[model samples]
Target: MIDGLDPEYLDACPAPNLAAMAQRGFRVNGNGMTPSVTNVNNVSLVTGSYPETHGITSNYLLDRQLGEEFYMESAEFLRAETMFQRATACGLRSLLVTAKDKLRRLLSDGATVSISSEDPPGWVVSGVGEPPPIYSLEVNRWVLDAGRYAMSQEPFDLVYLTTTDYAMHTYAPNDPESARHVTLLDEGLGAVLEQAPGARMLVTADHGMSDKTRMLHLPAELGRYGISARAIPVIKDRYVVHHSNLGGSIYVHLDESSDLNAALDTLRNLDGVEDAVSGEEAAARFHLMQERVGDIFVLADPSTVFGDPSEVAMPAGLRSHGSAHETTVPIFGCGPGLDTSTAARFRQNLDVGRYVFEDVLPPRPDGLLS
Candidate 1:
C-alpha cells in the first residue's frame, strides 16, 4: 500500500506491495467521488451511497450558518446510516480506525475516542496554524501503542491503523516528505499485520492529493463580481473552466435570483468557464442534496481550481480538491481470500469495504479497537 495517501502521488507509487495486492485483488481505475474529500468519501464507502444519500459531503462541512466551524464529534454522525453500524447490527466484528476521528465515529459511532485521530479533521487551516485535525503522527504513535497494549490484554476481532492517511495529507504521496511519512505508516501497518497475520488486513484511503501551485481564491476574486457571498462551500469540485463572473454565496439555502438567465450569461462569458450548471445538476453530478449546497454552481476549468483553504501564507490558494481532476489514492489489500492481483478499475475508497470483508457489513474488533 502507498504510505502517502494522495492519488496524485500514486503515479509515483512503487507498485510492488500494491501491485501484488492488485494481482491478487481488484483495483480502481477512474477517479473517486467528487469533493473526493476524506469524510465524505469514507462515509460513501461504508454506506455504498453517494454523499447525498449519506448526507456528508466534506471533511470540513459548513453548518447552516455557513460558518467556518464544523462538528467534530461522533454524535453529529446522526446525518445518515453507516456500514460499520450495519456490521454491528449483523453481529459482525467491525473495526473503524483512521487518522480522522470523525471517520471512525461516523463509521462506528460511540465506539472509541481517539482524541488524536484524523477526524473532525487533519487540516491545515488558513488563519490558525495547521494543527493535527484528528489523526496524524500523533495517531500513529497512539494506535501503535494501543494496538500493542490490546494484543497483550486480549485478541481483537478487528483492528484499524489510522496514520497513513494523515501522513499523505501533509506530505502528499511520492514527495520525499511523503516518503518519510509513508515509511512511518508502513512501520505501523507492519506491526499490525504481524499481530493479526491471519485476520483480513485492509489498507485504503479516502481520497488522493495533487501537488499543485496555482491557487484560486473563490471568495476574494468572486467578491469583485456581483457573484459574491459571505461563504461558498463548493457543492462540486472547483471548476477548471468556470464562470468567473457569476460569483455566488453558499448557504443551506438557494436564493440566487434577479434574472437567472442574465446571471448565467455573464458567468458563461468569462474565461475558463464551462457552463453555469444549476444546483440540481451539481447535486446530480456529485450526489449531494439540494438543501445542503448553494443554488448556482460555477463550473471552472479542470486545470484551474476556484479556491483552496489550506494556504496560510497567502490569501487562500495552495491546494484544492473539488473538481473532476484526478488525485491518485491507494486501495491496497492483504487478506487470505483477497486476490492480490489486478487493480480494480475505478476503485473509489468508498468501495473498500467490499474488498476488505466478504460480508455486506464490515468486521469489528469486539471491544479491542474502541
Candidate 2:
C-alpha cells in the first residue's frame, strides 16, 4: 500500500509499470475511511473492516481516564482479525514490510516475517545496504528493495508492503521530487512482480493528500466564546516534519461547563470549518468507534488544517491531509485470480483486503469469517 498515492499524483508522474498493470488488469478510484489519516485507514485495509470494527480512529488519541496521550500503534488495540493473522491460521507464511515502525508494530500480528525501514533488521541493512533516513524520499525505495531481497531469500504465501507519505507531504503532485518518488515506486513494484510472475498483486493507498494554506486551533477558537475544550489533531505522530502534527480533522473534548449544542453552533459558523457534529453523529456517519473519539468532531475545509496555533507556524507550500477531501485513492489489481468483474465492485480500500482474505486466500478451517 502507498501511504499517500492519489490519482493526481499518478497522473503527474510517469509510471509505466503501474500503468501497464492497470491496463492489463483494473484501475479504479476507491474510497478510504474518513478522517483520512494513516493509522485508521491502514487498519481498515488490513482488516477489511471500518474503524467501528477495527477500533483505530486516529494516529494519536487521548486516554481520558488516565489523562495522558499516546500514539495508537498497538496491535492489541485492534478489535478485528487482520489478513496476516488469517494467513497464519490457514497454515501459510506471510511477509510484512513497511516504511514506518509504527505500522510494523500495529499490523505485525501473525506475520511470519516483519520488517520496517525505520529500524530494519541487521540482515536487511547488510543485504540492501543502509537505508536512507525515514524523512527522506530514498527511504521508501530502500523499503521496497529490502522487501524484494527478503522475498528472494525465502518463500511466502502472502506479502504486504507499505510506504510512507513523506514525499507527498513535502512536495506537490507536480513537483519534480514527486515525479521521482513515483518513478521509484513504480520501478520497485515492477521488480516485485518480476520476482513472482504468478502472484496476484493489489495496489492501493491509505489516503490522498492536499495543499493547505491555513491552520486553526479549535480550542483557541472556541475559547474566544468562553468555551473550554481540548482539540486533538488526529494526524499527530512522531513524524512531525512531514506534517507538523497538523491535519484537517480534530477531536474536541469539551469541559464539563461547556454546552455541546452551543459549541457546535459556534464551530459551524467559524471560517474554514467545514463540518461540526456530535461524536455520536460523527461515529455513525464515518463508521468510527464512538468511544475512541472525542465528544465533538470537527472537519476543516480543504485549504485549512488543525494544529496548535502557537506551536505550529504555517509553513510555505504545506501539503497535508486528514479530511473528506483525501478519501479518494487509486486501487489497481493484476494477475490471474484478480477478475476484472470482481474488481469492478471495489469502491473502498477495505475491499482490497476483503478480496484477498475472502476470495484469494483459503477459507478458515473453522469456517468462521473475519
Top-TM-score structure, candidate number: 2
lDDT of 1 by residue, 149-196 (tens): 444445445454444343543454546865554444556556665666
The CA lDDT of each predicted structure is 0.48, 0.92
lDDT of 2 at 186: 95
Score residue 193 of candidate 1 by CA lDDT: 59
lDDT of each residue in 180-261, candidate 2, tens digit only: 9999999999999999999999999999999999988889889999999998889999899999998999999999999999
TM-score of each prediction:
0.70, 0.98
| Model 1 regions more than 4 Å off | 1-4, 8-20, 23-30, 60-74, 110-152, 164-174, 219-230, 234-256, 264-276, 298-317, 340-346, 354-370
For model 2, the stretches where C-alpha displacement exceeds 4 angstroms are 367-369
Q: Give the lDDT of residue 277 in candidate 1.
A: 58
lDDT of 2 at 369: 68
Question: The CA-based lDDT of model 2 is what?
Answer: 0.92
Model 2, residue pairs in steric clash: none
Q: How does candidate 1 score on lDDT?
A: 0.48
Give the Cα-based TM-score of candidate 1 against the true structure.
Answer: 0.70
Model number with the top lDDT? 2
